[model samples]
Target: MRVRNRKGAPEMMAANTQYVVENPEAFKGKWAEKFGNDHPIHIEVGSGKGAFITGMAERHPDINYIAIDMQLTVLSYALDKVLEMNLSNVQLLHVDGSSLTNYFADGEVALVYLNFSDPWPKTRHEKRRLTYKDFLKTYETILVPHGKVHFKTDNRGLFEYSLASMSQYGMTLQQVWLDLHADTDFAGKNVMTEYEAKFSSKGQVIYRVEAQF
Candidate 1:
């Protein structure tokens, strides 16, 4: 997941500011107003390259989407994809996931997505994982009652750790698919991220889970 520094990445992001919100904090508690609709807001943390978010937005026009990624280089690519699609229901933000609550009000989000997020393999960095207990607490603060987190990963170790962490945190685990593509109920409806497509093509088992608070 090492991203190469693309020259003029910042400038490119700035040029595409129409789709990329420069100050996401300004939209706190007013995301529906910002979208000019009362549609539910769904956010994708670490939305690398925008494939999944953009696709979801396209397919589900009734829902508004905000794709957040910290790296300007990677986010710029996502911005380009949004612009290319001319999608009205989707927006991009260059921000860290750990500080998500700062830009979103309590219960402002209906659902959050974590697709192929960095696993943070080292035991010392467990807290940095997106599905860690601390991060799940942060998500709980922003989500409404019964709000859910839909997570998918290609790594088994990370998936197992996330299942245990979410359960331990007292979140309600609803649905789980140890091999998503092999699950008939979800495979057809599931939208593939860039990583998911690549990994699944190589016969990797994708794990998915839904947890509610």
Candidate 2:
């Protein structure tokens, strides 16, 4: 699905330099200083809107959250929500997920979230998948020892592919849910993204997995 580009999105992002990082690469290995504390940093790669990342920051005050997206228009939406909530623990980064290593040093990030990422279903595009082995290696590089990745998606094929990719990369799967909403025990533990809420409302099954590297 193509996101409608919003007018003034670039200006909006430019005005909010405090919450929107202008030069993320300059802060490599120094994210704790950027957050002004050593709180565990959790990032949502391909964070579509402000929903999941901002919600997580609100729930976990001790954890710093960074929302990364390549689309400036989409990131502007997230910026609006962060400012509306006056969340000090959240930051927005306008960068591609594939360049994560350029912005973070080894053991800098504690956790990662891949929510409803593009499947890149074409056989020739498999390497573009977030769960691809090379991408997994990048995640592994920035993640702390035993750091985990939490992934959610409505697409069955992508979920299956991600599961296999993570397993092949020697990641330990901590939890797997074929129908997350059907699990009564998972209530209150899951934070629904904009896409997750929309798809799940249509009676679509949500798949989730937690894998540790």
Candidate 3:
């Protein structure tokens, strides 16, 4: 999805400085200190437009959430939602996923959410996929021992590739749902992202999985 450049997006993003972390690298090892609690931290990679992460933070106030995205335009939209909701447990970061380890310490993250990430649907671009082994290694480095990754996607090719990639990286997979909306167990429990709601409404099946390392 190509995002149209929002005029004055950088200024808008800067104005919401309270919700967006200015120096995430400075809080690398002491994330809990920033949150003023010892609650477990959950991070969502590519948290475009903030629907899922904000909803999760609102639902699970006991857990801390950091929503990361690389684009300022998209991230500003997410930050706006968080501010509108007056959510204290959620923070937004305009950072690339490849440099995630720089903003988090080893064993600092409890759970990771990868919701509807780019498929990068090409043989040569496999390495760019978030679920690729290299990115999985990065996740493992920042994740606590036994930390789990909750992933959802409407793209069949990406979901299938992710399952195989995670398995190859020695992650124990569980709670596999090939058709998430049709699953009674997740009814009313699943928080849909903007992309997710759009895709599922059109009769596309959503695939989800939990992988623990």
Whole-model lDDT, model 3: 0.93
- Report the C-alpha lDDT of model 3 over 125-148, residue by residue, as the tens digit: 999999999999999999999899
| lDDT measured at residue 41 in model 1 versus the true structure, 0 to 100 | 93
For each candidate, give its TM-score against the true structure. Answer: 0.97, 0.98, 0.98
| Model 1 per-residue lDDT at 194 | 92
Name the lDDT value of residue 182 in candidate 1: 85
Ranking by lDDT: 2, 3, 1
Q: Model 3 residue 179 lDDT?
A: 95
lDDT of 1 by residue, 1-213 (tens): 869988998898888766889989999999988899999999999999899998999899999999999888888878778888889999888999999999999999999999998899999999899999889988999998889999999999999999999999998899999888988867568999999999999999999999998
Ranking by TM-score: 2, 3, 1
RMSD of each: 1.0, 0.7, 0.9
Question: Tens-digit lDDT track for model 2 on 1-213?
Answer: 569999999999999999999999999999999999999999999998879999999989999999999999899999989999999999999999999999999999999999999999999999999999999999999999989999999999999999999999999999999999999998787889999999999999999999998
Q: Please report, in order, the local distance difference test score of every candidate based on alpha carbons.
A: 0.91, 0.94, 0.93
Best by TM-score: 2
